[model samples]
Every structure is written in C-alpha cells, then in structure tokens.
Target: MPDDEPALAAQRQHWERTFAARAGMFGSDASAPARAAALAFREAGLRTVLELGGGQGRDSVFLAASGFEVHALDYAQAGVAAIQRAAEAAGVARRLTAAQHDVREPLPAADGAFDACYAHMLFCMALTTRELLALSREVLRVLRPGGLCVYTVRNTSDPDFGRGVHRGEALYENQGFIVHFFDRAKVERLAAGYELLGVEEFEEGALPRRLFRVTLRMPLR
Candidate 1:
C-alpha cells in the first residue's frame, strides 16, 4: 500500500511480467540449500512454517513434503496461483496455502503463528536498506520467540557489484524501491534481535551468481 516509489514500482512491474510469463522456472527443483533448509526445519521441530516472498512455492512444496504446515506468500497474483496449481499437482494442497501478501505491510497472519520462517532470495528483491530492515522486523514480529529465520541476500562484497546496470555507489532509489548492497557485518548488525548462527557465501550456476546464506535464531527470552 503506501504509494510505492515509482522506480521501485516499475522494477516490481517488470518482475511481475517476468514471473507471469515464466511461471515454470519458478517451481521446485533439487537445490542443496533448499533441501538443507527444509531438513534443518524438520530437525529443529518446526512443524509450522511461513515462507515470505515464496514466489511460485517451489520451496513451499518442498517444505510441505518434508511434513511442515506451509504458508507461502507472494505479492504477485500469478505467482500465488502458480503455487496453488503446483500444490494440487503434487497432491499436497491440504498442507500448503498460497496467498498474495505484501511483505511491506503487516503480515496477514496471527501473531506467533509459525514455528519458523524461510525466505530465499526474498530480501534481495528489496531495493532499499530501510525496506529490507522493515521487512526483517516484520518477519521478527510474526515469528514466535526462539523461532528461526533463514534467508539469503546478495552480498556487497561480491565481485559482480554494479554489473547489472552499472549504478553508482550512492543509494539507488528507483520508483519507491531502494536496494543497497550488504556485507556479512551489515547483515549481522541489522539482524540485531536474532542470534546470527552462521553465514555461508558461494557462487552458483554459470552466471557466477553470488549468494550469502544466513541462519538466525530469535531469542527465547
């Protein structure tokens, strides 16, 4: 809701079109990190999980198959619909719920509704540092005390910075969206309330993609 920054809106619109046109590329695949996250959730006794920016629910389907009650949220209408279709095809419709939710607004769920949360490639979509922090806080708010937050973001230290559009070092504000690069230290500082359990950086695929995978735990107290 709030009037989205125009540039941000444009970028989102671009993504919406891309997702709508290519829904097939968004579904479940066998990825090591995804499988690892699901296994971690199961071992930690997290039966209920909410996946923010769940895209087409590839991860959601995996989590549900792993026996977790999964709620997959995305802002794109087509993305949600694709997830729903995928769930039905997989025969896990009863265990998976796909809905349209703007993470910038209050999460459309009860407080402490889930045992854990997972966001793969969700935070990177945010264009601003403020938006990222706000989204992070909102994620914290919905999670139960001691619940885990596992997510990934592009690292500032990645050798490929500015390779996309050659944007300058200054904060790039497009429409209403803001995207700033972050290193491990910055992420740790922003995620203050949660204990930073681990950080892993790796390059994937032939595109030489850089990813920082992190696991954080909300304090039980």
Candidate 2:
C-alpha cells in the first residue's frame, strides 16, 4: 500500500477476477514446490504449517491431507473462500483454516506458533524489497526456533524474467500482474536473520519458468 505501488484493494480485486474467470487457476494437485516442501517437513518432523498466498487451497488441502495442521492465508476473499470450500470437500476442514490475509501486514498468529511456513510464489509477488525483508522478519517472528521457511521465487534465469515492462527495481509488470524476480544474493539478503539451508532450481508451467526453491531456518536460541 505504498504511494508508489498499486493499491492493495486493486491487487485483491485483480486476483479475485482472475480466479472468477476460471473454474480453477492452479489445479487440484499441489505444485511441485509444495510437494517438495511436504517431503522436507516430514523429514524434519514438523507438523504445523503457516501458508502464505494460499491461492485456491490446492497446496493447503494437500498439506492437510498429509497430516499437517495448516493455516492458509490469501489476499483475495475469493481465494480464501475457495480454500474453505476445498477443505470442506476434502474433509480436511478440521486440519485446515483459511483466511484472507495480506502478507505485507504482520502475521496474525502468535510468536513461535508455527513449525514451518510455506509460500509457493509469495516472495515474488508485487512487493518492494523492504516489504520482503519485513515479511521475512515476520516469518521469523512467528516460527519456533529451528522452524523452516520454504518458498519459491521466479529467478533471474526464468524464461519470462524480462518479458514485461521493467518497474524500476527487479520488478516487472507482466500482463497487468507484477512479479519481483530474485537472484541468489537477493535471496540471501532477505534471509539475513535466518540460516540459509539451500536453493534448488526447478522448472514449472508451460513456460517452464526457472524458479528457485529457497529454504531457510530460524536459528535456535
């Protein structure tokens, strides 16, 4: 909601309309990045997850079915509603909670509340570098010590990296949507207060965008 940025309300409407236009945006199966997060979480013996940008609840439902308690947040009310409906349909409503939440705002959960946080492409959303840093701090705040933050970002090497109008910083306004691309240095910088565990590259979508699955961990005090 910065003066130079798109209004938050407008952003919410954009996503709402995008979802309304189709029966589904993302399909029923969770994205590969999310599946990978599930594996990592299970290996780490983590149970509770806080998901940011939980569009349409595909991943949230999948994670809940995988036996994790999930709190899924999306900016658009439509998206949150979709999540709620999907959770009910999947009979994971007891394990899943959906809410409309803007990641730019402080997380609603209490400190040290979550064992892991997942975001498929939340970091690459149309947010300023400062906002990303603040969001990172918020993630650290809500996660217990040694908790993990697993997220994906369209990296500089992505096929659509330079396809749209450049927006001053690493951001590009592509087809009315904004994406802030990331590089390794940028990822590390945003993860300043956390321990950088790894960055794995993968291709997704018909465009096969080159994305980085960056994993960070909050240090134990």
Whose TM-score is greatest here?
2
Q: All candidates' lDDT scores?
A: 0.74, 0.90
Model 2 agreement with the true structure over 1-221: per-residue lDDT tens digits: 23346432266778888977764678899899889999999999999999999999999999999999999999988898999999999999999999988888999999999999999998998788988999999999999999999999999998778787776478776777778899999999988999999999998988878899999999999
Candidate 1: list runs displaced more than 4 Å: 1-4, 166-180
Q: Given candidate 1, what's the lDDT at residue 33?
A: 60
RMSD of candidates 1 onward, in order = 3.7, 1.9
TM-score of each: 0.88, 0.95
What is the per-residue lDDT of model 1 for residues 128-160, given as tens digits with 9 covering 90 to 100?
A: 556667777777788888888888776776555
Judge candidate 1 at residue 188 and give its lDDT.
80
- Superposed Cα deviation of residue 143, candidate 1 (Å): 1.0
Error of 2 at 59 (Å): 0.4
